[model samples]
Target: MLSRRHFTAALALATGLSVSGLALPALAQTDIKLTLDWRFEGPAAGFLLAQDNGYFADEGLNVTIDVGNGSVEAIPRVATGAYQLGFGDINSLIKFLDEDPSQPVKAVMMVYDKPVFSVVGRRSLGITEDPKSLEGKKLGAPPPDGAFAQWPAFKEVAGIDDSAITLESIGFPVREPMLASGDVDGVFGFAFSVILNLKANGVPEDDIVPLLFADHGLNLYGNAIMVNEAFAEENPEAVKGFLRALAKGFADAVADPGAGAAAVLARNEILDINTETERLEMANEMNIKTPYVVENGFGGIDEARLAASIETLKISMGLQGNVTAADIFDAQFLPPAEERMLP
Candidate 1:
């Protein structure tokens, strides 16, 4: 008769079981559907890179990425379980959580340390290099725009009288063109998106002045990776693996934004490589690769700063609820500190 150990080993080999007689499950891939906050632009290259490089596959995940109409729209998609994951504005997620505290969606990673919110105006339109210049100017704002949603907060901090400004509701497709054609004196939008879109619409880059909200007393963090609470609860390992793959992709993008942009171009062949590359670089410098992110690593937030942001949001957005930072973000799903460090 064969020894017990040898017999067990033979049984393991015959049944694809462990030596301890535990049946080994097949390596099953988790299916994840991810929605982006916007089109496949420069900033989206990192996710594309992750997909192209098989980062998701390495973690036993099969991720499908879809373009979204806007950052605000992404929150609802994830909250409704239409998407298992999303890249969206954290502020929008906070507002959604306040309105429906039962919604099982929370930000898992901090992608943009500095909010990309800004007011892009033409210097020729009397917008001189000051936030006060926006007073009395006609501003184009998209109703669903993440930046525009925060305008009340911006108005409060910049000390601008709401009555002094004429607000024109415009669609995203025409916001840049309208600004370039002088249809509006200024517009609220993400700096990187608006700047390049304006340039593409024939606006002189020199004439554009971007008044960043972060510079003007908005301590809010920007976009992050948000996950559906139910999906995360059932598949914590999958969630962690998703973040790990995403961080790897981000780190790779930081090392070579050109390569990252190329990955984006592969997905949408109609995009102009040069323009998208510039947009990606701009987003990295002004939003993603901030000093704080460099020091603390990516995929995490500073608790103190996050609390202060909640207080600012409460005052500026006139938010009425007992919502706190914990409700909006759960950093527990983030990858390890070392794995998130930029190259």
Candidate 2:
């Protein structure tokens, strides 16, 4: 019993339309709920910017991005179809699929070309920017943290003997504070995040030392955009369109990080723009704008490297050989290379 105008408006709303003042041609809209690997900090700018800039709408997608607790947690959410898409660690996703090959999720775009996993420690506690320094130290690690999950493989690659190391299963909230109090000598977390947080906690820059796993013989990919298999199967074009929009969003973020930070600030009012801007810049320089990404464009990975990573995971993560690189990633949804280049 709706009028023509009312019906049109309702259709638009149901299809995830961002209503403007003018009338426009009606098109079908697909709803996509995306769960991020962490809070709405600077790293989340690319996804947030795409949504705020109407790139998703341009692709006929009504994308709802939700904040998450951890990258590994996003896997089960996507696998269970609770979220149609997610951003998470591809390493964990590989293990998840190895446990059950039929999980309804697969990584579509590589976000962090360099893994954010690092061992952040204090110089006063005798920790250095060397992996061996961790051998006899007390380290705080959150069990669910993505970086902590890398230890089994990280220790193997870096040849760190844990016999003398003591581990504390601390919660995420207390990680920096504990380190600041010198209750723990070091912690496992993203280098940029941990370094900035330690500084925020009154730790001096000269006292902080970060030893990244990637720089210490771990050649693994990091977080990525993944989609639920069922949803992607039902809407392949929507999947493709989503990736395309994301590429545009990342490109825009790379071009103007301030704008990207503003988008994140819109979602999280409590965060400082300058800090968020710096965090965004770190992610851009350390992860998103790697030499490979800059040279080859963004959102795609080399198949050979992925295969090699899987082989490494077998030793580091104890994979049962149930999954392959192709099983974990599907690159067909990515846009053309030239279209994904950073400005």
Question: For this target, which candidate reaches the highest TM-score against the unseen true structure?
Answer: 1
Q: Estimate, for each residue in 1-343, the C-alpha lDDT of model 1 and write its tens digit.
A: 9999999877776766786656654456899999999999999988988999999999989999999888889998998899999999998887787777899899999999999999999998988767899989999999888999889888898887778899999999999999999999999899999999988998888999999988988889999999999999999999999999999998888889889889889888998899999999999899998988788898899978888887888877767866888888898888778888887
Every model's TM-score: 0.93, 0.92
The residue ranges of model 1 lying beyond 4 angstroms of the native Cα positions read: 1-25
Off by over 4 Å in 2: 1-26
Tens digits of per-residue lDDT for model 2, 1-343: 9998888878776775645665554576899999999899888999988998899999999999999988899999999999999999999999999999987899999999999999899999999878999998999998878999899999999999999999999988999999999999999998878988898899999999999999999999999999999999999999999999999899888889999999999989998898888999999999999999989999999999999999999988999999988999999898999989988
Per candidate, the number of residue pairs that clash is 0, 0
Q: What's the residue-level lDDT of 195 in candidate 2?
A: 88
On lDDT, the leading prediction is: 2
